[model samples]
Target: MSVRMLSRFRAITHYMKLPDDYEDSQGLQFRKEDLNQREVNQIFGGAHLPAPMANKLLRILHGRRVAGTLNDPNLQVNTAQFSASDQRKALAYLRANIPVDEVINAGLRAEDELKLLEREEDGEQKPVETSPQDLPPDTATNEIPIPTGRLPRRRESDSPYGVSPLDRIRAHNIAKREAEEKRLEEERKKREEEEALGNIGTLQTQQEKPKKLSPMMQKMVERATSDLKEPPEMKAWERLLPQAIMTVLIFAGCAAYAIVYTPPKRSERLWPDIPPAAATCLALVGINLTVWVSWRLPPLWALLNRYFIVVAATPRPFQLIGAIFSHQNFSHAMLNMVGLWFFGTRLHDEIGRGNFLAIYFASGALGFMSSLARLVLTDGLIYTTLGASGAVYGVIAAFFWLHRYDEFKLLGYPPDPMSGPQGLAFIGLILGLHILPLFSKKAHNIDIPSHLGGILAGVVGADLVKKHMDERARVRAERLKTMGTLEGVVQVKEKGPEKAPQTAAGR
Candidate 1:
């Protein structure tokens, strides 16, 4: 027999020795000695057979031999009879001659040919298998079978892992490239949207515009377009009127106090000249009077100055509280009072009266310290800084930091165009007016440092408290998220009971 035939015979014998499930039992069963030449040809015939059947046939012919009597033409034979001893002899003959490598190569070749023929009969292209001959001379012979799914088969150049190492690296590079492209696309979209909103009427034609408005329409349009146009600032008198009336009433009350209970002066003042306790009592009295009469009076600038202003740098500590109620002018007093009214109302509502008062006084004390620090640092000599402006600026800062998202507009600026931060920025810009000594040349006359100090004190105080508020909000959000997840689980559990009735009815 040829080497190929001997290999085939050995493979069949080997396959038959596998577990029972892998064996085929069809056709003739033979013993070792009863088998003949006709049975051998029948087992190895050209008829197509499954792997199991072919293996069983080869096993039956394993060690059998051709009888000399069967070679004679006149001999009668029973086609089905084969002895176990004869089968063993044939198998032993084939195994003794066949090489193991030839057997493996032939089996693989046959499987490949069978697949190719099946595809061709079905009018499909046959896939080529990678072979030892196709590989480089130095390539290793031991290779694992590559996994293939619905995707097309790989070329010889492809790695056995289906994709080349370089291809995997290239794929990762492509993903990064795509992510960058998407980010740029989103940024471009945002810029386009902003540009479109900014040029609202650029695309509109002149004729498409509304005709000249009637008087009513003009007023409506004016109101609608007020945000687009800046308005004039309040005149000094208009701003100061509220403070001026309050001052007159305060002076009248002080004149009564002087007449009724002998007012003290530099020469006639009680011992310990401006006693600390007395000074504090007087300051509180003045503040109470200011608040009282200012409620009834139209403006209180003079009253504020009398109660709060202290000129000496080393003045009694009580003067700090006093200084917060003082004002330089009617405009100063009115502005401070206006700020207090606006911010105090909302803050008092949110934080409650007690906390509001605490914050207000704490803010005033901080502002006073800031002013004192500024004086100590900037000038060797102490100069008095006075004004409710510091305390009120603190209140405004607190409001802004606490309600940063709230929309606000300056008197001479657009409405809803500014948020709390923008409003604070506006205040800073106005304060800058006091610092422009080169341009305005009168910044030295104004206590710019005191104002800045008070603003900073207020910002710091408010920020400290606001942090606690923000943390509370964050904790609450997390709790709600966890609660929602638990609720979903409960709903799923409840659904089990609701489905049981339907399932039982169907059964």
Candidate 2:
């Protein structure tokens, strides 16, 4: 038999508490005593059993046995009378069967053998009789007498079995169920008590009213609230600096042109009849120059709306793009240009030049569309509005979208506690400020709808480009994987199997 089978057989015999003489059909006796350290090691190819198992097996072998049983076949008959050489041979066999350490450590002596025999004799001793009264009350009564009745008296707690086995089981089950229910009830009460305490604390806090703001604090709050309104006019130079520089440069260019190529006398127009492309180019230069001069010269703002204005008599699609480069005042142009410079440079770097231009133009177009839609919905006369505010607002939207996690402080707000989401919230608040006036008893002249339209356009454009790039990358990865698989298949086919030669006779 295999060593594993032998070990399993020994374990089964030990567990079943079978007699040593018990034999199978093959007459192979499983003597418990034979499952010693040496024999156990041999069964497992001399591998070391864990110390606990080895110790357990040792205890089992040493334990008392049934009386009058024959000597176990595993025990050597002349072990007690063995010579030195015989003992050495036996020890060697034992070591070879079991782990060397187990064989060396195992000290089986004549005294232990005699003790086993004595234990066996003691285990076989007959038990003395005891009185029923000496036992515990529960175990004392082996049976109960039934009362005489035509139908067995139906006791309250008894079933047909007289002892009411069902009643006992039912009582135990009911007790367990009641205990579980009680535990759940206790937990529920504890949670309710905690919640009640919390609510009481909150109520008490509310009852104790907060102190009113101090007179000084009240005054400060009033000042803060008033500060939100439009501020007083700036200095004369601060207002006209932007327009002054722009006017000087414009007249200088016009004068230079006139000097270089004087126009025919009696020309009806003071301005040259420039081509459409040159006109557009001149318009851009004028807009940029106006913005720059506005930053340096503030007084020229008064005449900007009258002199530098170009009104679109009929609303055209390109007017949206054109409007962004148009200005009503030096202040407006300067402010718009400042916004663009601050946000546009970084945005251009992030999305690249092509994408930036697309986003800017598309957002401005959307803003114009919003304005046109508003005009149609209101049935109001189409009014000319000009500024780079819509396009600049688009750049701001793109900035927020790309760097949503970047933090910045709102003007006149607490500094250290600021965050990106909070700054965006402030922007939303300002937009609401513009929108709320529409419902009030005031002229809602500002083009609030166009700003919102531009912001929405910018957000959508950036997201679309991002998603497109991601999809392109994913497609490229899938193509590479396919190519690799194809290459591997081709290589396998290229290295075809070599053929065996056939004999001449077979051929």
Candidate 3:
């Protein structure tokens, strides 16, 4: 036969559940002593099984006998001695079935063993009858009357001495239930007496007038009542005024310092000649840096980092612009500020405040997007890039376009101080910094592509601004010519003749 067919046959035959009439079967008739002896023999014989395993098998066999006897109390068969072969068969059957529910089977086994032991002890201490010679003459002549209703009968498997444990357990439960019922009944009677007293007390309270409050309490009650009146609701502006004032003060302070306070290079001057728009932008950067300092607190840092840093892995479009205003440390903030002061003032002078601001944001955005795209392609999600380096590079590009970078040294390096190659060399130097970290383990974080992206954006933006300046100027001049007082309405005729439409309504 095939292995599969053999397994199926074993599963059908040996795997059957305990028989329904197992209580009447001779297999479940073994005494506790016999089962224990067999278990000890198995362990001592150096059987190739764990001690606990043999013990568990014995317990399961005992439990099976107890579980079977649940319905048939009178079932009995001689089981004082078991053969080695029968013990082996019983152990195999237990191993197959008992593991299905070890806890429950073990419990049943223990309970049955305890009961059998108690029964055996009681049987051994059976009551002895006195002889006629030993008894008193009067006691010997008297006879004890037996109950007529029933006679005590012993089952084949019952103990030879005291009453069965099942009968004793039933009696104990009946006594306990009676005690609990009595306690509940007494409580009910006490509750009835209390309820009667409560009714009398309530009636007396209804007949009596309420006691007056003390003088001090009356005054306190009046004050409390008076204080409970609703206060007048605040206007929207009144409610928001403090927050608005604080915000304005913060921005105003930063702006005043940026405009009036001369930069380090022009420290000798009383005030720097910074334009209003550029000053405002610098002030906003200052506010962003102030918030950045509070980032030492983990929760705030996480919030700011997510909103401000250009996270290449989890890129958010808004962060592209916000990141240009963010700085990691004080040194980082100072370096960006120096860059801005050097190039920003010059760019503002050349293209006007509005155009400068537009180019600055556009270039920074393009630079962040470039870095984000490259990181995504490289699968560098954990990589992060921040600071205004992209915008600073954009300013540098604009400065180079308008003047010359030959005289200026970028980060203390200028290969050619007065040549066209200087600009290209400076760009190349920056790119080298970005690439150095990849090759050398000692080098720090550098985002070379962002600088290049900004420079390219700056060039394109500058060209566009220059091209549109004339058209923008002409439109501004026309708006000024049509300016009028708000109190007086002014109408103007079209310079060109109006053309009639070739439609049915015109006809």
Candidate 4:
């Protein structure tokens, strides 16, 4: 088998080995996770722990939970981000703050609980896991009966677990909340079903009392909703595939158009009757301008930003396309439009409108995809990027490639057109300005990846077009060579060999 086939086989096996969703002994479905930072962080934060403590704990958990080592009995989970002395100091602080008897009793209780767990895991008495503070003080003694199992969540309201008035009041509040949560879950399911059945509008029209949520309940709801979501990296992979598909689809579209469609003959046009190349440029500018104007409409701002901007945090693959013709402000929109009109028209006139658009859309999509890939690799997935600079760069690069030796004007010219070498130097200067800033330690909003990708696409696109054109020219020349002996036709002499003169060629 080939190396690619072997790699694919290995990937399939790896995915097959990944832990899947399964039901526990209680018939409750549990999704086994290799790692989910958001789920971990949410659960940790929901526990009312200090942010610093939760963060530190997470670092330690992550340090020990290496990807391939998961479920490996040999891999001990003892290492932490904190050094030995720091951990020692922390333990000492805890010891100083907590009572000695309480600590000793807690340790004893914890040890007994672990012993019970081991026995239960080995098919002996089922063990119960309990926090030391939650149990009675007598639980530390040998005479205290070992717990058989854990208390089930969604407990009975009337179950007696506390005695004091304050405790009773608290339990009552918790019971009320549990009931409310159950009701909300049912409502959510019903809403989902209604929406799926296309009856959501009717359902929404029905009068229903608004449910009031306490701050605690609101936090609970937020945590619950986000808890089951897959990891950002996983979702990122899902989004990446669509963007890749879109890029390839665009490329195919461009290729198909170039292969089949022929442009109409070029003709001079009067004012308002724009040339094909000019029309194409104007249409692109109009698209950018329309999106830019939408930025001003407050109602559509959220929708536009979400759909138009390429956000790393919540990436939408289609945004890569939307973002190409999207500009946030007037200055940015105008700058890109001017660049498009200047270089785009030149390239468009040289290439047909279809081929020009092929280069434009394909370059832009590929450019953003390249940038997103780099960002994901570096864990800078929270970033955002937008604009047509990448597509514009592509146009510039193609134009530069086509007109390499063409002399052009420059800033305050000394009555002489800039030489080919001068133009080359000027192009390098602009690219260098963008490239040099990336080396600095400071954070920059500039998108180096899109620019580089665009330039590359342009250069490659130009080379391919040149190659195709040359092939066609060669084929046509061959065809002309094969067409011989046409009456009243003059034959051009070959460069290499001289043919014998034909006296009666006109007959």
The CA lDDT at 243 in model 2 is 31
- Regions more than 4 Å wrong, model 1: 1-322, 326-332, 343-359, 377-382, 397-425, 437-446, 461-467, 490-506
List the candidate 3 regions with Cα displacement exceeding 4 Å.
Answer: 1-274, 297-299, 404-443, 470-507
Give the candidate order by descending lDDT: 4, 3, 2, 1
Query: What digit string (tens of lDDT, one per residue) describes model 3 on residues 1-507?
Result: 656433322211111133223322233322333335456555446454444444544543444443433223232222224445545665565556534343333344344446556766887542242222233446665753311111111232355685566765575466446545766888677767656666333444553455687887666445433242342344434423443354334334433442344334444433368555467457746765775675554445545666688765455556775687887788877877788777787777776655676677766776776676666667566578887878878877766655434545656554555333455566566556656666776745667678777887777767666766667689888777666542234322332234433354578
Candidate 2 lDDT over 440-488, as tens digits, reads 8876556777788778767776776567557767989999999999999
Segments in model 2 whose C-alpha atoms lie over 4 Å from true places: 1-287, 290-313, 405-427, 476-507
Error of 4 at 20 (Å): 84
- lDDT tens per residue, model 1, 1-507: 656433222232222122222212222233333335454545444333343444444443331111111112221122134344434543554456432323332333344356656766898753554432234455375663321111122242545676566765575466446545766898677768756665233443443454777786566445433242232344434423333343334334433432244234556645447543344334533574465455343244334433455433333445556676655466666666666766777665554333344445555655655555555555523366776666666666776766655556657457454433455565566567645753664436466655665566566656655664577689999999999999999999989999999999999
lDDT of each: 0.49, 0.49, 0.55, 0.61
Better of 1 and 3 by TM-score: 3
Cα-lDDT of candidate 3? 0.55
TM-score for all models, in order of appearance: 0.32, 0.34, 0.36, 0.48
